[model samples]
Target: MSNESSPLQSSLLVSERMAFKLHRQGMIMETIGKNNAVCNEYPSPILPKERWRYQMVNMYPDSGQCHPFGRR
Candidate 1:
């Protein structure tokens, strides 16, 4: 039909951009728990509002924060 992305695709693109921006701003914490050497390590039992700042368990396969299967 048209050379335009569907609504779902547009939303996904926006989400990706936001995630990238957050990551660049250091607002997205990539690790948690004792293993990470960084000072800004995210809390293990992450609070509700703080949850958005941490990397998603399912997204980071090699992260020590949680297993790729989504278990911490």
Candidate 2:
């Protein structure tokens, strides 16, 4: 049999990419926050279309403004 993985079985799924992007952003924010002191509470891996996370709860200003998660 041929060796191949289905779309669902792929490691780099859409959700995985989304999470990775979020994590990367968070790490950047944490670094900037430490430097500028404007950022507190490193943002957790964010999800798409999550209005609740839009709030600055323990997060820096305008965090994840690039996309509100649900945006295409």
Candidate 3:
């Protein structure tokens, strides 16, 4: 009898544990822009204005909300 789990099983277990930990910590997931991109790196909540400026500049360029035009 093998006592080892398959790679997929291990990964699933890890993911489940991570989700449980996040839920227990009251860490809710959220998106920063219209693109619905996930952001979980920051432990603290960032201001919506700051996030909008950052995401807009990083994700969009032709919109003119960044660089020399917007200077944000």
Candidate 4:
């Protein structure tokens, strides 16, 4: 594996750092879910706001929905 960050990876890391700094300064940031149009353009295995998927799954175990955005 090459120990180098791709342009996209670098951008993500920079954004994550900036978000962390903002969070420490008491600025709240909301993650827009993967279903958003922008995310589709960049399609990745990792979903944006992935934590919400886990929370939803836990809350609706019997919902019978396999997707984070609910049934198609």
Clashes per model (N, Cα, C within 3 A): 0, 3, 0, 0
Q: What are the per-model C-alpha RMSD values against the true structure? A: 11.7, 12.5, 16.1, 15.3
TM-score of each: 0.41, 0.27, 0.35, 0.35
The digit string of per-residue lDDT tens for model 1 on 1-72 reads: 144357534544455556556666667564644655645554233222334433344544755552121122
Instruction: State model 1's lDDT.
Output: 0.45
Better of 1 and 3 by lDDT: 1
Q: Stretches of candidate 1 above 4 Å error?
A: 1-3, 32-72
Winner of 1 and 4 under lDDT: 1
Q: Rate the local accuracy (lDDT) of all candidates.
A: 0.45, 0.45, 0.41, 0.42
TM-score of 1: 0.41
Candidate 2 local lDDT, 1-72, one digit each (tens) = 124255432422454465667776775233237567575676655433344222224546665553333332
Question: What is candidate 3's lDDT per residue for 1-72, written digit by digit as tens?
Answer: 144367534544454455556645657445444555754443323222233222223433566433221222
Candidate 3 regions with alpha-carbon error over 4 angstroms = 1-4, 29-72
User: Could you say which candidate leads in TM-score?
Assistant: 1
- Point out the worst 10-residue segment of candidate 3 by lDDT: 46-55
